[model samples]
Target: MSVLSEYYAALERLKANKPIILPKGSAINNDTVAMEAGRKRGSIKKSRHAALIEAIEQAAQATGQNVPSPAQRIEQAKTKTKAVKSDYEQLKEDYEKLLEKVNSLLLENFELKQKRI
Candidate 1:
């Protein structure tokens, strides 16, 4: 139940790609890893947690696993979503322009038919 034990457990979970369970039964992630490990959020910069963080990074690198930390994954998802949303907006604008063009052509054709009648 010590902080060191929690830190080690978190490291193992990271290596195995398992979720780190917090004391309150919440799943651990990058943001919560330090807190779950009995340290402040910014404590990762501290000497002890810094070394642990380095170890985790090295382990992941050595294993050739691309398991992204939660923060990284969230940022990546946000970027992708933004791109998709932008594309969708552009398509919507194009569709509206095409519809307007079609309506204009239809109106002009109707006026010609009325004159012929």
Candidate 2:
């Protein structure tokens, strides 16, 4: 499997609450380490962003300011988040397509050699 595939699989396994075996001397025994790593990697930021937006809405209500509805705020956040995620997804798709093209070329090259007898 490609490195990306392995990494994606590992992430899925981690999400599924499966134990991910680590190499000797690696710090994977403590789940907190992984959790902290994820938090530092932007998951915490997303959660905090959501909480802050909610708080802002609440404060707007308390102050009698004309604030957008909660749904509108959520939709706005989603719209902003979609742009970032779409970039990553597009890159991933491009990479996968490149990988497929390379594999096809390799197979075709092997077939051409086999017919050279």
After superposition, candidate 2 runs with Cα above 4 Å error: 1-80
| Cα lDDT tens digits for candidate 2, 10-56 | 44443344624633222221232224233232232334345433443
User: Against the unseen true structure, what C-alpha lDDT does each candidate score?
Assistant: 0.69, 0.52
The positional error of residue 71 in candidate 1, measured at the CA in angstroms, is 0.7
lDDT of 2: 0.52
For candidate 1, lDDT tens digit of each residue in 1-117? 877677777667655656544543333334456665556765565565667666756766665746677899999999999999999999999999999999999999999999999
Candidate 1: Cα lDDT at 99: 100
* TM-score of candidate 2 relative to the true fold: 0.32
Question: In model 1, which runs have C-alpha deviations exceeding 4 angstroms?
Answer: 1-65
